[model samples]
Target chain A: MATADSTSPCTEYIHIAYPVSPIDRVTWVDLPDALWHEILRFSAVQDLVRMERVCKKFNIQLDRKDRSHGAQEQGREREREREREQEQLSSIHDLWKTHCQHRWNDKPRYKLTDEREDWLRRHYDEHFATVDYGDTAGGATGRATGRATGSRTESSHVMMGNAAPFPVANTASSSPSTTSTPSLSKFSWKKTYFWMEQELARTTLTYDELESLDWYFNFTPLAGGRGKDTLLRCIFRHGLLSIGGAGFPSLPYRMLFLHPGDNPDIFSEQQVNATDQHSDTDTTTDATTDTETHDNPIFHGGIDTSQARRHNQEQAVLIADFPLHYVSRLHDSGEWLMTNAHVTFVSTDEAGALTYKDRNFQ
Target chain B: MADEGNGIIRLRSSDGKVFELTESAAEISELLKDSPREEDDEVTEIDIVRVASPCLEKVVEFMKHYDEEKMKEIPTPLGGSTFNEVMDQPWYQDFVSDEKMNRDMLFNMLSAANFLGIKPLLDLTCLKVTFQITGKNAEEIRELLRLPELTPEEEAKAREEHSWIFEEA
Candidate 1:
């Protein structure tokens, strides 16, 4: 065997060829569009689906296509989303229809104070003459502005109360003359708040509203007052209506305190925790009550009421005994001034001393 | 009114290109016979305005050869006799793939094959079209096709409008 690189004669000449293959180079465009479309129809469904999404040309062919299998969960999710949207739309419609239905009845009505009486009459009296066909005849003296006129079909009795500065619902004005415009449109918050305070003070006892208070609200009937449950009722807070009614006014339903802005929790957890410390009943001052219990016949027999109380007093001493020893040991070690000792840092001095400082309770 | 001979059709291209062929040759095109047509003295119209004069001459060349090959390639059990024979040859393939025959000649050949209902010629020419067009970028294609440039304002607006396309790219 001779190698081309080693022998000059063997490497003298060489021949190479690069033949072309025409049949090997073909693509979708090789076929007529109609035949290509038929081939597309016959393709394994996966390639057909991917091709349809790949370009606008394939998209055109996919216009009338239908799929027999797709993600079933995705279909269900879409249907559920559609249903949720429909429900929200219906709820909004119902809320709006409720407002519309109550148009004339319980319509947001207003009345005027002495300062405002003139302007309301001037703007509204002439147009409202035709509104209440009966006002012309019944001589009711007050006309409602946005309040209910004829809405009476629904089940709930829409009291038609004014949204703010609740008014006297009197409707009687037969005159056609225009009243002069008044100066002030806005009412003073102080005036309204004072008027509310005055109205609430008139109530001697408030108990019925207390019935509405949830457990979180401090509710107690005003002591030593007599009347209908509604009349003799006062809560220690206002704005109770928010639990089930109108806007939240800071003062609760009917608050009673020795002073204004006083804690509604006057007898609540704050008082209980503060006074509970004095309730140990095991203090040395009550030691005789504990010692005398053992000599009493009822304390041993557990039959007499006084003896039962004596026994309880002794039991309190027994329970409080252990926690106090640590207090006593701590005191002996360094004068136990702290019964509720909170230990922060434990350090001993070089002078052979154990130092305990009262930790200001955080 | 119904008197007729063995089926055959006469095709006339837009450039006064006349082709006479049997019914089967014309019928290979699904559209040729299915038309609810009323026969008239006038020759039928087939649009071939794009078939440039020189390429149309090549198109006629390819169709003449393709029809002859197709006749020999197909078989039928006619009159209780069957004949199956195939000639091993490179003449047909070489005629189609000759690089000296320009792209226009190939395009015209493909169009004429569709019109005259010749299948193999259509396949060969269409494949050449695909090879020429595929894998070309927009700029390269625009240059090859001699399209004009986008205005400066249009370029800016298109950048904004198709920003997402660039984002994916």
Candidate 2:
């Protein structure tokens, strides 16, 4: 608990000046107004906000750029992020498509045949609806259901015994014979929801040995205050998990996944070769070892550049004694928040029994 | 009407002196634009001897160049443009040369930045002043700004409010 690494640099800034030089040193109107104008134009709005506070002069309380500015700035950013995610999904689709249809190609495509097109689109719509930034249905792009409606079809295929010929959606459009098999019509439309649920279910982090990561920050989930404060404090006694974009306009996104008690440090497990890595081969891990085995959810895909919006890695995340939600809102303006998507927080259900209050030094 | 930029506007300094300039020159004060339209008439200047007439002249010069997009070439607080070269403008040198004149002007400029709510200009100007005032003791601060030396009681009040900085002697 009392490690040298745990305690070191402490930087806190406080500003106070008396009547003679209320802001101390100099004032702005004194500077040629031209100099002031130039300074305002170049900086990002966020940085300007902070620079403003340093002195009464700089505190230009710019009304947050009007709606148009926010749309132009933040909206455009959202669009770019969406595009990047789509591109990655498309690549993943290609692999699934090729391997299922024509293993011949080096890479496969997730062929959105006519039959599954609508279903797939619906699925996409539904999936995104429930995820982070929720509920507002996007403009229905005609391409949604028109693509892979076939594979995700509501109809069933005839299965001959255990080989339960799954209605693979990636049937090649080029393979004409593969289409219209009467055999496909003979079966029952079994709702694939069970399998689908299994596929889409997200495993909560720290299900196992991941508990050691508690040192990262006070990850307890609690809403700090009901009023002005809107900050989710990430407390840590020692280890620093620098979480988001840096300096002033920083937005943190990268998540540090943890689980409850598999060997949180699996890399040290000598008997087993890397079990949680690329190979899907099963290993016999006892309950204790299982805890150790899946300790940390290593981004097997590595640091995703596509996900590094706002320079995600630059943020510093620490463990506070409580959950981030417990900290008062840093900007809780009655806006509905979606976990990880809108400022950080977890509802009481997600992070049981945490007490945090909203407090601000300012 | 199109000559709104060239329209006439009047600015009265804190000590009841009025100077009429084109609307554009007056707009340089941002306080007008940012203030509630209804309150515009109330901003009639009181005295700001801290901003000397010579400094006002320089401010006008700055506004003239600034209106023509000159400020855009200068860096701002947002995008990290440290165009320090702009500070080297000859007049900037002369403005600071007569410390007494610039000192008063600097205070005015700071007040103007505050009134206008323009962060960058305020930051740059204030930062310049900080360098001028940094490390200087209270007596020097009062003398440099021409404020009369504070009476013991007044000095104590000021210190009490801002005890964050302490004299170790």
Candidate 3:
């Protein structure tokens, strides 16, 4: 808090006449080039990219000779003479290869023979371009139907459907890029690092991101439904379903679901019919209106207009008022196990806190 | 002075303040280990002209508590968001936390650590700096470091050249 010109209050009585020397107060800019390099060594790749924008000093420090020194002929000549031997030993390709290995150490190493490809950028694009959230229908439909059903069985289906295609689709998309590269020479590892960070921020939901959403579903169980559902609330965004309620653990449990494809009609006919019988005409019309607004293709199949009308009416009514006639049968039926969804549980620790656990999901 | 025969080394700061430490503790700094010793009264005294009293005091305190076995290795590309999560020792976390160390003092401590060739302190200070720089944009980083604003032309050119970084995901 003390400024360079302000003398310490403790030192005022001892040295009232003499002011503190300005040379003693050092700023970040005053640090020597050697110390700057030491600090740069500790920075991550994304930090290095942003540091270039901080000031010209950092920009010049982080700039590569090939990219930044086009007009400086004299400096380039000197640099060439100084780095002739070093450049031969460690090429730009080797430098980026080391970066790729360090950042994605867990990824399987590939023996690449192509010299023209920018392996680091390719690796980033392949791994992060599309974050698999399971099949599309599984995410969107599961959310809509789960809100309507409000049963533990439906919640399990939502998890299973959302988790099914994530790991499999991710691996499927990433493998082909390693072999196919025609325009990778234009990319740089530093840019790729920024892109990866951006993609990560987009896919992963922070506590703040969750709290900002206006719509959330609280599915309290109807009579005869097992367990107390008073505290359970679910928020779905970017194909991620976050479950948090009162008395739940401090960690917010999140499930990632990817593709939003066909709606498989996971709802049982008997449950749909029973709920439809209890719904009044006004609520049925409102449910139809809600379905029309979403315009989702998943709900269009396997139901006649009357059955669909009744189902929509039941869906419009809150889950608390709906009948739980099919709860026992759905629990014993094991119907949620239809998909091969590999559900990975992602839990955020505390508010605005990001840990290695979230990064692993990326 | 009783520990003069026990290999106690005396370090003199630029502002005429002297701090004493055992030779084992002093060995944490390569500069201290390699400094030419004075044989006055069978005690060693080395002058460090670059480090002032306040920075040297911190350096000496860190060296006194230096333990090779207990020191945790700081991870590269920092895996955790906060320094407390990354650093296992609470004492080490408190050493560089904002409550105890200000920006100027932290930079000065870094300079002193660098000048004295203390690798662990250097790494710890740099890690603290890296934590500050992480997850912050360029303007925020400039504000944190108290750097002056760039000229209008330079700012536009820099942004134009690195437009990808400025774009939202």
Candidate 4:
């Protein structure tokens, strides 16, 4: 692509009898190094590395740049120079970071969270592990229990694995005393497994595909064994589904829950006029809706939960219920995600009475 | 704030050559614009004394083509790949081709553009130099820029250290 053709009469002014300088041996070397860097600034990552091999002068520039990243290692005298160089390197790193994050638009990108940072640190070392209870014990029992009484508990004898035991307030309908009950012990300690790669964001769950699923099951389990309150707590701990930028789906992806067909249950469904619109909901999910309505079985709660936080929306959907029976509010916010969950007690009796519990964990 | 009627700016180059350009064309050089000048001054003389005469003359010629009125019509390329492609167009081709301006001349213009704060000229010159050396191997670039060759051992070490970038090539 290098060509030098005289485009205009401007060449008339060109001095042919100019005295040649001894420094003409390296014409580029005569230019200020900063101008060279400005030229290199437009170079691609691969080209930048390639330029290091150009000559000792260019190589030294690249070497200084590489060293500038770890400025802490430099001696005291060059500290200020290293800091300035570090600033330039960081701006480039920011561009690389944005490229890797898959940012597509001018929309405000999500900030990195401590949880995601920890996850990324572990990921680079291949140490990041997430226990997926849904694939093994939870999956088998979830299928065995059928639809109406979808709830199942793990035996307390089962090893908890890496998942440390946290206190759970059992709010099972059998004991409405508002006090801790003995049945809370019946909930089995679910074994947590370090997730293999395929389960991490891609196929495990599409954060934006909630409307298509019977009820979107993210990292939180649908069937809570103990109390509804504890289930809400577990959901709060785990339900904050990951947004984009930190992990996978590196595009401007979001679930626009404001669509007409997707009636977001921001408040109790009871608060809204109960129209006979159940058929429309069933039509959306089709056959899966029947099974989900009858059973409420916890599907795949895709394993890893990133840091979460509740922002702006006072009534964001945490735990989404089908046909507007329940709603969850943003109870808690972690650095990376915000979670809301709605837990409803299904009445097996013909009375058809249902209890709705809304909880927040901020 | 010089009078608009038939005004001209005289610029003295580093090699002691005096070149005259219309004030409209001279305005493209930020160095000329920032200097204090009286409205009654007939021919405003600005010393672009740091740039070589030939490069200063070339800058004047480029400014003549893209005077303030014409520059408004050319779209600025979006960054990255698009910017590179824009530099390869016919207009830029005629301006940056090696046959018209050799390596030393372009380098001279680059320094001149920098000193004068003529942004488009600076960018065009930088793009020309970048395209010349960007994809070429070290030996090829050394031949192009006429730099002394590295010793065999240094070449091998550089090759080894930067093998990752060479992998794609």
Q: What is the interface RMSD of candidate 1, in Å?
A: 24.5
Q: Pick the DockQ winner.
A: 3
**What is the C-alpha RMSD, rounded to one decimal, of candidate 2?**
27.5
Error of 2 at A252 (Å): 31
The candidate that achieves the highest lDDT relative to the unseen native structure: 3
TM-score of chain B of each: 0.48, 0.49, 0.87, 0.76
User: DockQ for all models, in order?
Assistant: 0.01, 0.05, 0.18, 0.17
- Clash number for every model? 21, 97, 12, 27
Which model is ahead, 3 or 4, in terms of lDDT?
Answer: 3
RMSD of each: 35.6, 27.5, 16.1, 18.6
TM, chain A, every candidate:
0.14, 0.18, 0.27, 0.21
lDDT tens digits, residues A1-362, model 3?
11112234433221122233433677777776567656766665555556666666644322334443444556767667435423322333343344544643432122122421234334434432333322221222233234332222332333333322112223335554444453433344444332322221122222333333322122212212122332233444444445565553333223222222322233332234324345343322222223332222222121221211111212211122222211000121111100001111212212312121110111
Better TM-score candidate (2, 4): 4
Fnat of each prediction? 0.00, 0.06, 0.35, 0.26
The 10 consecutive residues of candidate 4 chain A with the worst lDDT sum are A163-172
lDDT of 2 by residue, A276-346 (tens): 25445443222222322322223111111121111111111223321111111111111111121012332
Off by over 4 Å in 4: A1-26, A55-362, B4-6, B68-90, B145-161, B167-169
lDDT of 4 at B169: 43
Model 3 / residue B62 / CA error / Å: 0.7
Q: Which scores better on lDDT, 1 or 4?
A: 4
Full ranking by TM-score: 3, 4, 2, 1
Q: Supply candidate 4's per-residue lDDT for A55.
A: 60
The true-versus-predicted C-alpha distance at residue B32 of model 1, in Å, is 4.0
lDDT at B91, model 4: 57
